[model samples]
Target chain A: MLIRRPPDLLPSEITPEPLARGRRALLKGLGAGAALAGLGLPQISQAGSLGTLRPSPLSSDEKLTPLKSVTGYNNFYEFGTDKEDPARHAPGRLKTQPWTVTVEGEIKRPRTFSIDDLLKLAPLEERIYRMRCVEGWSMVIPWVGFPLAELIRQVEPNGQARFVEFVTLADPQQMPGVRSPLLDWPYVEGLRLDEAQHPLTLLAVGLYGEVLPAQNGAPIRLVVPWKYGFKSAKSIVRIRFVREQPRSTWMKAGPSEYGFYSNVNPAVDHPRWSQATERRIGEFIKRKTLPFNGYADQVAGLYSGMDLRRFF
Target chain B: MTFQPTPRQLTAIKAALFLLTLLPALHYAHGLWSDSLGANPIEALTRGMGIWTLNFLFLTLCVSPLRKLSGWHWLLRLRRMLGLTAFAYGCLHLLTYLWLDQFWDVDAIARDIWKRPFITVGATAFLLMLPLALTSSHAAIRSLGGKRWQSLHRAVYAVAILGVVHYLWLVKRVALLDPIIYALVLAILLGWRVVERIRLNGPWPTRSTPPAVQPVVFMKRDAAAALGVPKKR
Candidate 1:
């Protein structure tokens, strides 16, 4: 079977060399002002906004999944379960503008904020992270947002707060799948307060430099790097700081299958599927799944004494 | 009287059905060529094979029920072909999981089959299909003789039930739509058979042939009750 590989757009956005991985500040063609100012519109018109990200040390040396494949193949149950369903249903149906996130509960400044207002609340930066889905496929995504910790700090949690719950939008008019009880409708996810405040936990607003495509969770979404992709709730509408663990949608949907922590542990496989290895998008072969999605070095301390297998 | 195709026509129809069985693989090939298998082609491929395997299983199970329902006894001629196609798809699904998925990690494969309930049932269903496929030939059928061949093939109903259970448990949350449909089908197919037995006599396979149709030698006397006809010794 003779097939032609597309010419590499290398020495461009994605560099192969590990040393040049995080040199995204120099590579970003759009100024920060342009990206910030264009947040009001559904589309970001800036040329480089959808191009090479301003990489950081957190970016991986591994290959980057194509933006087309990344956005096209998604598992947003709000749209549908098929990988192509979200790409087909979300773009035209989802209304991203006029979106507001309610940041209430256990916070001193409990108030609703728009996409632009969230920008004002915190600065945006690019961090490339490997997103491993519990389905056993992984992708390295260049995400644009600030640390979720920054927003948590800004909100100022009360001392009694021990967990943070994130709720996704449940509008059947836009998200057709919300009409079905495939999952508990208002898809909820949560993190331990410390996990929410971790430097790696990002409140992503954009991806590949542009504002997030609706299917990719436009406006704002949680991007917890260490957990399975579902734990990184999308199109987040509310953030609740509570004293105890909240009922996360997946955990509630299948308690034994999807645990509360849902961390990326290669050793503990899902009852139906294995977690030992994952097929990276665009590649034929799978690589060994890293513990904590390769951030175990930084995040392992959070679960020091607890048994992951039982919790998982 | 029921309209029946001639032997020549039946052979042609069987050939067509054989080609129809390969349509799913052809559709997958087109998807692979056009790059439409989404971000995860292997996942799509694995899933496609698995779905098709079950699909053929249901089609095979439906043969007897449909024959009984519609009085289309000719449908039985295609049962072996349908069953074999299902077995072939099951092999592909397993091979894809082992080679493309586990990359021949024998230990992981063993652990998966042992640990995963869904995989255990699915593997059992697949393993059961192997003997049925091997004995599908006329030579094996003759060597085993009619009664034992019929007895061995009777296990297909059990295999079909296990296949549905495998699919039902394989999903993350046991989403009922698809699995329930499969279960309902297996239920109806199996239901008709039990009801059929009571109508024939008691729950035992007796040596009986109705005096009403002594010359109806090719009517599969044992299966006649399931064929919606009463037979007596």
Candidate 2:
């Protein structure tokens, strides 16, 4: 698969050759180690590194957020509610290898694909996308994954499949926060069929050219660049195609604050806080939040005539 | 068991408490210097100061209940200092938001105070604390007269309630455990005062003069006089 770098990206902005080569070597070592440790065993292993990543034209040319910040700060409520809780607790708790994603409901071909199968389905492209949180913060993340459309096409949704729902793992033994009644367990998120099939929508397995850390939804996760970060569900174990709009976890938690569309529109303020501006993760001063998180040219047509304030 | 701290012991205790209260500020400062306050140091600093402000407010409210329960009049000697410390931290919290977070952008600050409910409640709570802090000095208390001063200072309860509400309103509903805990603590403190009021008098207000207010004792009588706190009648 031939991949083209983003036109705006400078040669200097690409990952250094030595670092990329070293990471590739580390990934090879990890694969060997996993094989030696009894390939037949079902026990999950730790995430190490992802091999060579092809730069995609879809990538944002903006400066990448620091890997430390991306890995350290997270909103994975299954681990805990605090931003730092996921990093503190998920490493030792979550088991990621031998993972399988069950694709079912309203699809022509429903099948459970193991993590290895999913990784080999398509070439992993490094797409740097701007991620905006509903809580007035944002990050630029280089996610390594293929378009969700690739997997969707493989499954071939039936006529009845109007929406797709993503469900995350919620084992109490693995996720301590699952014990707390924060939201209904087995966190669920959904997207309209077209939105899910968007070329920008990704099924990310790694970030920053490395296999995702446990805190960052190891094995696989969704990355919907146009929506608020929560709309991109993490540590997904199931994807179900549905006939009707599925109620997401956040919608159930706060219906007024978190709407189904959840497209990043600065005009639609959250009931509690303004969506006008966002503090970029590392920056001190807040910057004006863009409509559709600056993907207006690509996604504005999706919500052309709808009232975002009402939908939001 | 009955225990009463001596005058010298009271001064030492006050001195120790003063130093202890500064620790949270120092910790945030050191975190900033070392670049260890996670991804957003500005947020950590702003939030750390705000939480410490609430802590001091809780500590200030604890004095009355602790004094009444233990029959230790000396605890009142520390109340003014504790209240003042809460005000100090409140100032730092607001400054951090205005300077670091907002970068002294008057339009943005105004927009936040006007548009955001959490900011509205937080700013109102700080505004209400100002008069109480100003009247905290013995001279101002004397000028306002004890009876009127006490009534005015009672606004602290409102400030405490607003502060907790501000916290509750700002956080996402899923992460409300911390704010709810603060609300519960304030409820118990205020409830204790309510139960004490009914026990002392009756449930209803009476035409007759209520019992004498608690004596405003100080660490040293001469020092108290210098500070304008009247001697116990």
For model 1 the TM-score comes to 0.85
Instruction: For residues A119-183, write the lDDT of model 2, one tens digit per residue.
Output: 88887778999999988899999898889999999999999999999999999999999998979
Interface RMSD of each: 2.1, 1.4
What is the two-chain DockQ of model 2? 0.59
Worst 10 residues of 1 chain B by lDDT: B210-219
lDDT by residue for model 2 (B1-233), tens = 55788889888999999999889989988998999999988888888888888989999999999998899878899988888888999999999999987789899789889988899999988987887787788888788789767766777777788899899998887798999999999888887887886787875346275432221211122222333433232
Q: Model 2, A160: alpha-carbon shift in Å? A: 1.9
The sequence of per-residue lDDT tens digits that candidate 1 reaches over residues A252-309 is: 7888789999999999988787899888998888899999999999999999999999
Lowest lDDT 10-residue stretch of candidate 2 chain A: A36-45
Candidate 2 TM-score on chain B: 0.87
Taking all chains together, the TM-score of candidate 2 against the true structure is 0.89
* Residue A206 lDDT (model 2): 82
Model 1, CA-based lDDT: 0.79
Clashes of each: 3, 0
